[model samples]
Target: MMMNHCGLLTERKEAVPLKSIEVQLEVKDHVATVVSTLNYENKEDKPIEAVFVFPLPGDAAVCHFSAQIGQKHIVAEVKDKQQAKEEYDHALSSGQQAFLLEGSEEISDIFSLKVGSLPPGESASIGLEYVTELAVQADDGLRFCLPAVLNPRYQPQGSESPSVQVTSVPASLVPYSLSFSVQVSSPHAISKVESSCSLEPLQYLNTDQTQATVKLAAGHKFDRDIELLIYYKDAHQPTAVVEAGQASAKPGSLMGDPVVMVSLYPEFPQSVMSSHTSCGEFVFLIDRSGSMGCRMNQKRPQETRISSARDTLLLLLKSLPMGCYFNIYSFGSTFEHIFPKSMEYNEMTMEEALRKVEKMKDDLGGTDILQPLQHIYSQPCIPSHPRQLFVFTDGEVGNTKEVIDLVKKNSGSHRCFSFGIGEGASSALINGIAKEGGGHAQFITGTDRMQPKVMQSLKFALQPSVEDISVSWDLPKGVSATILSPPITTLFQGQRSLIYAQLTGKSSETTEGSVTVKFSFEGHPSKNQLHFSLKPAEDSGLTVHRLAARTVICSLELEWKPNGQQNEEIKKKVVELSVQSGVSSFFTAFIAINKDSPESVQGPLRCRIIPTPLYRAYIDSQVRQCSGKIYCPPSGPLIVL
Candidate 1:
């Protein structure tokens, strides 16, 4: 049974400790720094501990966490995950207040925060800051999302463990309030800032129109995620930013060397772009889990995710080149294939697939995508016809890292194009597989027509694959460069590729440096170059350095193995880098202890779980009536107190 007050799921209804959240965003070109402050007050008579699970963008680097308890201030320190957990447990056993924030072991985007030993009527404020690179949309705008919903991830039976335990209620019933504001600055004029939610009018801060401020409209209900599309006048122009190293860090280290972030927008020649390859293999993987029966968004309650996916699949099937090979696969607790093997695209095959797709239902019990993926990858790829795999899902899978690793292992034979079908989809799953599989990722949400985005990706698939990509650097004598990010493997027309590099040694402030990217597309070689000053931008706050560190850490993590001597060394390096850079990783956590408490309270600490808002569609579809009351099904129960 759901409680009326904020729809909390508890044996005994009580006031939620979380009261309000305030967010501040600073955008410099395509990178953003977000600082969120959460205010909490213990209204219970005895001491209590609260646990909250939340979502963050998969690529973000959390750099700061602090807490203010009454008049005492404590700043968290990044430490080894086990050590941090031990410290937090010890503090709690000693009757001292403590806080522990950790990233999910299985999923990168899911995080859990524990606020322990809050005294009765005492108030605390938490501050969390992170920096991330904004993803470029199919259009020229940059996209930034603040995820407020944590949908339950479906765990297959016999899996190791669930990523995170999420307690969710309807969006309209969330208790806390949110205040969000953004300040944007760029090299070019800010054309506009659009959001899926309501927002106040944009306010330009400077006469040049390069600086602006905007805020969310008052009284916004915490429902779907907040998405902002920021547009600039010259969005396609290539640029680079060099950030100085931290002065306190030791030299010759990652944090000590100056880092440069280069943004490249590759433009294919009209002749090459106009021609599309007619010979290739296209495989479409669709999700038919029970949650797919839910509506796509609040505005279109009649349009369910399966329906939209079906319509998009129809368009994709009709658009295939005549000579291409194709197949269709759908997965849930089990999987089905339209054809036993890849077949030539023709009228008969197309019609058969269309008829079967129309009759598909969302009766599958849970999301178990690994088996289907293994089956697809096991098939021998047809020679002379490149394979392109298209995966469409609401992104509810629990084995994200394993799936992404499998894709990376099989990437040589196929390129994967991924589509996230609805709100609260796992960005880590969608983006990770696409990035590892050497293709593109797209998110469809909030009245978005899946046709356009899917069609765009198909166009990318049909384009001639780029090859022989290489990067070169030009710098003054005695100055060298070290590449930090993984090498660029795929390039599309008008798509942006970001490169991060470290500059070692020193050069004059007036010295200049340049980088050139060369690649072969459609049998034609092309190059793009950007030149910039050696001097770092003043007061840049080292955003580039942190982002570069995250890039290197992710690459290192992917190289790690479960039971290898080399993997242990790799894990140690990741921990050291994460600690030195103050960035969150799979092996480290942020821990804070309140040492200056006035007194130790003598009482048993009650445990409370702050429920995040569930998607309205899930509430409608998953809840079942039983014996005059409504309850969620046992197959995938998301409501837990």
Candidate 2:
């Protein structure tokens, strides 16, 4: 093995020769449309194939892809997954250049774009567009996260076949530069915009403060996920928007159907407001896998994943209510609990847990979170106290759908609050668990403060839940509505619920539409009603159709079952929807044009894997190479008192 100047054996290194990236986001109302353009140039004297693995929000609807090669611009079209892959392979085999972009079937949050056969010294510009709803943060602000971390995902042994394999490099070695800007528009006045990264001052384009623009400060590196928090003066107010269908498409289809987006943000009843005094059973599950041995932020090697998790866990331990029951479980390959059963949250128990947490390290084997989660769920629930399960992990699990299924199966026993420990945390795993378990998910990445987010989830877990949630729509005399989104299963205070509906038939010029969301809180039924004109909003584009298609596909795909017939049915629905909407899905992919031309210049090919943020284990191993002996740190046994 080769050793560096530090007298340490270096990890394997791959070359990713690339240039720059420009990202532009247009947020109208609460939906964000993102366009990212990558400029790839091969400095080598050979034709090269570059595979870039990137991150997108789990719920984003990717609608467009295009590439410009030597002044010739070509746009990609959606096709069946296997067919697209076949064509991409053929193009590459025929000594032609091709670009293939596709999302992971196992992990929706990760995407891979393969640009093959770039001639020497020539540059290819590839662009992609996606739309996603801005989730309301715990602090009452619209949150937009541009993922820059492509940390390696942990694939458990004996797991299902893998789909996409992610390769990562150190943050400093990620060879690409990123520049981003966002244009924000909403009916409500914009109050403020904030981010973890340094940002240029918000530029207001109108006197009423309804439109504004913001950009990342110059010199900011793409070391971590870019998060932007947008605050509106009246963030919780309900609003309705009706968008026109595509004029060139046939009527009655999703593309031709008039769609409406209803955002309902109802405040929880005063009786449900909770404080620390509220009693509950709190179970904390921490991941101590090898990956967790990595640093929480690449820029700061001292603040490791385990160390950060311990600090946050201690804060949570001290914040538990005096009379609540609590327990701690750490899992990697297997699992161990702090107590046989959840113990009372008294001074002695907390101190014991804190001490154990302090001594915790990434000594466990590969990450197998399912073993511990299944154990926790199988245990009987305590009487009178609601159970809230808190999971802290780096989101490296490969059995994501399986874990989420377990959460959903056992959801009746407890609510789950998930935390993604680092920038590369899988949004699919974290968000899916929370959604299935009827709770909330938070991400602690880069230099983000963890206290507020964890405390916020704690507050929500302690609060009373609303039941019997329902939505009712009233349309014009001839108009009928179909709900494109799945049924509402749970509701939390401060959480925003959005509904998308397609209107069929016709409405008179004076006709108005109304929607009412009803749920029972405390001991009575309450309703929130919004009335709006049926007239279509001008030139809203295909945002509504794409979003609606994404919603239905997501719903169908999630309806997995034990029966083979039912699974086949779901697969068919997903593909049908993806093809009809021209949007990417688990069963579909986007492939741009690539072919051999008479002017084609052929040469030897090179491969580059664009590195994402580096992992600490790889670094720590290098540190231990100081004298070819494994470094051991001294520590004391944990004591309750």
Measured by lDDT, the strongest candidate is 1
Least accurate 10 contiguous residues by lDDT in model 1: 625-634
Query: How many angstroms is residue 300 displaced in model 2 relative to the true structure, after the best TM-score fit?
Result: 4.6
Number of backbone collisions per candidate, in order? 0, 0
Please identify model 1 stretches exceeding 4 Å from their true place.
1-13, 615-641
Highest TM-score model number: 1
lDDT for model 1: 0.82
Residue 590, candidate 2: C-alpha displacement in angstroms: 0.6
Residue 200's lDDT within candidate 2 is 97
TM-score of 2: 0.89
Per-candidate TM-scores read: 0.93, 0.89
How well is each residue in 252-309 modelled by candidate 2, as lDDT tens digits? 9877888888888777656545332488899999988777766666467677777888
